[model samples]
Target chain A: MEALVRPKLQEAYEAVKRALECVHFCILIANCEVKYWGRASSKLGRGQRVIMLKQDGSVLVHRPYGYEPVNWQPPGSRLSAELKDGKLVVRAVRLRPWEELVVEVYEVHLLAHCKLRDDARFEMYGSEGDIRDLLANNPELIEKGLKRVEVERKVEGGSIDILFIDERGRLVVVEVKRGTAGAEAVIQLKKYVERLKGELGRDVRGILVAEDLARGVRGLLVREGLEFKKIDLRKLFEVSKEQGASLTHWLTRC
Target chain B: MEALVRPKLQEAYEAVKRALECVHFCILIANCEVKYWGRASSKLGRGQRVIMLKQDGSVLVHRPYGYEPVNWQPPGSRLSAELKDGKLVVRAVRLRPWEELVVEVYEVHLLAHCKLRDDARFEMYGSEGDIRDLLANNPELIEKGLKRVEVERKVEGGSIDILFIDERGRLVVVEVKRGTAGAEAVIQLKKYVERLKGELGRDVRGILVAEDLARGVRGLLVREGLEFKKIDLRKLFEVSKEQGASLTHWLTRC
Candidate 1:
């Protein structure tokens, strides 16, 4: 790892170029103007931002505020940096889509680079898939007399999250969302119901199952003749924990 | 600025704690396990991740592969670092939403911190507002005989981007998107057209203007009886540049 504090423009440029060549993750705190041309063209005027060039060829330019990067290039980009006209210019380009991001640095406050090793897989709970699995196992969580027919039933265009039969024997098509269910979720559920109604020639009901509904989505769901069910993720997580604990206890006893 | 390479766990923890107290942006490259509980709960196993703690109290954990932070806390979070049980633990908490993110570091490869000064505003072109402005000024870009009625017409729920009168003398409601128009965009345009139809008691045509269309959005637009117009952003940018050049020339002569 190499760290240079308040480095000269030329010195920072040399270090950045060397880091890129060595396939190291580099961080540069600089005042820079950024220009990006790819799917869309945008130019950000000069500002102090943190520029991160990852070993896997991902580039992120983050402003002082906000979680999202002001400018970014995904993984598998080609990166190069040089000193041009007394300033440092770093460019990242992708071949297939031909996207390019250019950062012209006027001053460098700090520059650091190091090789990172990360191989552990990410384990996430309370995702959309987890919610779907819980609902599949416990259909009563959705409704009292609902019975799960199939989970992830494939249709023509996409797959239905869960297909259930209500007490009235009507087919219910479910769409699961981990976050807020928006107008798009309602449209998706409506589409699934329409497709199932045509294929099965039966009365199909669409239900959008999510943690919460976005503003104005309830009216949209009502207009589409679909239903919205709020799932408490905390409760779901507790139930899942209990199930896991019981399973572990049974295994130990066996 | 301070940089420590392959320092002792205790030494790194003390430096991180001091940086937090001094209101500095701190970076720690370490093998860590992260747990976040907030809008949702997620756990990332022990891996080498880049942890950025900004002076504004924002925290980001990057896993080296993607542009997005695997775990993040927005600005205004309360941050603290400590050493416990032969490991370093960093915590960030938000009060309003009652969210917390904890990163337990097993090994620190690199640790750096610096006070960053940034107060520059971000200026960008070819955003949604930019597209709307261009379409409002030059309705011919959308269609030959289209005339703009209003740029942002306020409705009950939200504001329409652009409202135009087509050659057929029908009301056209335009929803401008900087990126690809997805199913949600189509649904939004449909809602706008419906609202305008009710208010005007006239035939309203819904047109979704975007740089591209997401998969299956074209079919959704068709089913919703809406129109899709692909705007070439590069051409729009060229026209904008020419306008700017002419405007600058006019100013200089004046």
Candidate 2:
């Protein structure tokens, strides 16, 4: 379902069929005061709030800014409602891991419901090889005086994305990723550094590169004495073209 | 600010003017393989990967299905690009928490860049007050023969969301949350139950009700000998309306 505008009470009823259904989406607006009775009572004075409902029987009462909802009901709950003394009442109940949600509505302005589609497939983008070629030819695109000495430099452990010689005459092993770098990437880079160090008979610095780094990968890189670089891939292609339509040139040759 | 597609290399260069400039969003499609060289070496064989770049200098390469990217460079990284041997080469470098990303593109299909807007504001939602009112009137909506005897029944510790008498006439103390029911809710319910048990002159069984329960809240409920119930707010509202057009009747009376 796309969207619903202001819905009457009956329309609201039709929107939420059952808790066991796939998923239902509903939005509600109301102006009313509330007080809860349980281990204690909480009183919310007369005001307006928005209410969202899901088909799985989940509900959320949201406010501004904060991520957490003001009130909510978890999924797998039995739901029912009624009106008492002119106020709208809603109730949700569950058996196992039991819970309940009761809402009182003083005024209702809009109730929107929608059904989300889950069968849509996302479009595929490029691949890892494309990123590699872009970075290999333009070693200086990463750092000044950084010269790309070799591509796919083989090591006992694996392969280096680019073998570079910095202006300081130091061997730099470059690891490139076209995707978000994870802890696994850090570990992989460390392995290459170790292998390159033995072959060169000198300390070889390692660089872990990717489009994005995951939450904890950066911290691991620091501990392992490694470096990381971010690349604006689109810029790489753009700069390469300005350097002489290299991509078009390469594509034609390939 | 919107989107740039199939831009020339110069356009790409102009779009990514500086590392410290405002955020930029770039999407690149490439046919590329990737490798990591640091403490180790890891290779991602030739395949398709979507590379995403942000003005914050963060980049992500995505494949399919997985939530995390195969490789990434975090923010605060200096970005540079160049063309080498016909390949589009891109690199990102960072000093503090040092890191780097080197991308070599074998082929490029698309390069899309956009600047996102931050002026959007979300709408508000209904509140805890509504839930409290809904449950207060229809205690049975939570549990059969459960009568809400009082609201915010206070004890020495705190107020309970609801005070009820079950079918067997035993006191049931309920703690309600309009939001996620977490460890805090369990603790709060336990305090109310302990106090209510003393004042009610009989054993008090506690139940915690909320829109949803968080990770550890259930374990806490078990430890405290309390029960949990999930609520579906929309169904509750729907059921209430079917019971009677009470809301409309009340509105008309008002």
Candidate 3:
């Protein structure tokens, strides 16, 4: 990791381009405001936040309050920075799925490049198939009266991670992700819901069940009329073990 | 960040999906090998390395020996995991770019999620532009005979950061990046060189000058027929001070 402290305007300007071009992930901690143009013009008030630019050209404007970024540009976006009129104007744009971000630099306290590595080792014992099989056998993992009808349910576009029958006997397609769910996973879940709705000849609800969700994904899920559920696999496994269920059997079956 | 110990197979499976769905960056440190299928199939022998899945769906397999990952999948790739015959098979694929990665996990030691944040503040006194300007004014920074012709030269795609004439009187387009330069930076430099090639009516050499270059990017620069030059801004600033040159003056002039 390399740290840059209180660089000049031109230095900061060049840093943005260099960071974007070099694929060196950067976190710009600054007290500034953001302005957006292109599809719809908007502005954000000055606040202390972190602006993370991944090597793949993704940009995230994150405030200190939440885990989600206030604004972002997806991967593969082209980033440009200029020191114009004493302000560092940083812009990121993508062509195919059109998106744009413009950040006006008012004050930059610190900028650092991170060489991310998985430093510590962790032993992950359980498997996704284990969760699926557990849910398939035990509906209680979801809620009382809701039962899982099938595991790895196949659909038109792809396979649904889990298919369930709610308390009211409504078909539910559950998309599972390990850590925090992002916009991509939600979009995928929406597709599954739409596909299942047509195939089942009825309305289907989508539930994105993950250990956690990115700051903004919950809003997206609600807007898309889907549900978000946080499930802890480690705890779930402990509970299953207390019930004396055969995990090895479930693993084999899955 | 969450840590699990010797989790059941099902727990592990669910963890992978949850991690991928949720945007929590994951580091899978395992004693295993990898097999990639897309964009030219290849396999890596068994070794101890870290497989990092970023919040943006990018995957990097890094070994301890080098700064760059042995294999990587760019952001926006779709990752899927399955437990087949007791082996964890992880796959990541991208459509538009046509890339795929498959990792067969024979054994797993640890899996962890990192909540990345800048814990400390750093003050970068001088700037990359200062180094560029100093190098521009003082050819000795690069070599004795290299002289900068233009600070920011206009080109078709965009402006080349710097244009210099090498010792051999050959045109050299310089792209300066902070910290470590990656493949993306090299690719951008390549584009600049290609554009300059037609306009200059001669072979325009390219030099990616940065604080450091990532392990993989060096090879890329060589393969692309470009040059890699390391320029330490801190050292250059110190040298400028010794020369009695006012950095503030040079900065304002640049």
Candidate 4:
């Protein structure tokens, strides 16, 4: 790892250029102006921003206020740094779509580069797919006497996330969403239900399953004659744990 | 700005603690294990990762490979650093909804802190709203003799983005998407058109307008007897530029 704090412009530029050659993850705190051109063109005036150059050729220029980067270039970009007319210019370009991001640095506050070795596998629980799998395995969690008939059943419009048989022997088309179910999710479930009803020649029940419902979603579901089921992540985790999955140990160890 | 490279765990922990007191944006490259418990539970094993603590109380744990952070806490998280049992521990917690992230550091590679000042206003030229406004003013770009009637007119399902009267004197419901028009956008436009048709007792045309269409979207639009318009962002920018907007100056300066 190498770091320079309040270094000269020439020194900082040389260090960044060297870091890019070695394929190290570089961080630059600089007062700079950024210009991006490609799908659309944008210009950001001179300001202090944190610029990150990743080993995967990704570049992120973040301002102080927001979570999203003001300007970014995705992975597989060609990164180059040069000192032209006493200003360090960092350019990232992609070839196929012809996108370019140029950062002209007038002053450098801090520059650091290091070889990062991150091979850790990230495991996340309670995603939409996880919810679908859990509900498919344990249909009773969604409703009593609900039996899972098929997972991802293909119909006319699209695939049903989970097909279930209710206690009354009626077929149910389930649509699972991770965080919040909105009007779009409701409309999607309606399309799947209508398609299935046309093919099966029977009245198919539609259920929109998600952890939470967005504003006006409940009313939309009600108007469409659909049902909403709230999914509990904690209970899903517990159910997976009882089945002796590795997630239990991972959560408990944490 | 202050930076420490290859420092001892105790010294690095003290530096982080002092930096947190001064509310500086701190960056740490370390081999650490991360655990997050909030809306969901996640566990990441010990590996080298970039940890960023922003002045806005946002924490991002970035692995070396991807654009998104493996673990992140939004703005307004309480950050604290400590050395416990010969290891550095960094924790960030949020009060609302009770979310907590713990980073147990086994080795510190680089630690840097600096006060960042960024107040530049970000300007994006091409967005869904921008496209809608441009089309509302120049409805002929959509179709010849198409006159826009209302912008965001309220209907039964939701607000129509732009309502236009076509050359044939039929009402047109235009749903504008910035990037790619998909199945959801098609459904939303259909709902608006159907609602208007039922209410006004007139034939209404539905048009899905976007920069591009996703796979199968064209076929879906044809099956529904709807229309699809490919929006040209470059042409829109040129039109906005001719109208003497600030976007022209910004792009030209870049």
Name the best candidate (by DockQ): 4
DockQ for every model, please. Answer: 0.19, 0.02, 0.01, 0.21
In angstroms, how far off is B77's CA in candidate 1?
1.7
TM-scores for all predictions:
0.59, 0.29, 0.31, 0.60
lDDT of 3 by residue, A1-254 (tens): 45555666677767776776676666565666676543333467666555666666667665533222456665567878787777887787767535457787766755655444333332223456666665566554554445667788788878999888775668988887766789999999999999988877997888887778998778888999999777765445433432442222211122
- Give the DockQ-based CAPRI class for model 1: incorrect
Query: Candidate 1 residues A137-158, lDDT tens each?
Result: 7675676557789999999889
What is residue A228's positional error in candidate 1, in angstroms?
Answer: 19
Q: Rank order by lDDT, top first?
A: 4, 1, 3, 2
Better of 1 and 4 by TM-score: 4
B165-206: candidate 3 lDDT, tens digit per residue? 865678988887867788988999899899988877897989
**lDDT, candidate 4, residue A29?**
86
> Can you write out model 2's per-residue Cα lDDT over B52-86, one digit (the tens) per residue?
56555655554422222455555555666665676
- Alpha-carbon interface RMSD for all candidates, in angstroms: 16.4, 23.0, 24.1, 14.0
Instruction: Show where candidate 3 strays beyond 4 Å.
Output: A1-254, B114-125, B128-130, B133-254
**Clash pairs detected, candidate 4:** none
Native contacts recovered, each model: 0.43, 0.00, 0.00, 0.49
Kindly report, for each predicted structure in the order presented, the TM-score of its chain A compared with the true chain A: 0.56, 0.47, 0.50, 0.57
TM-score of chain B of each: 0.56, 0.47, 0.51, 0.57
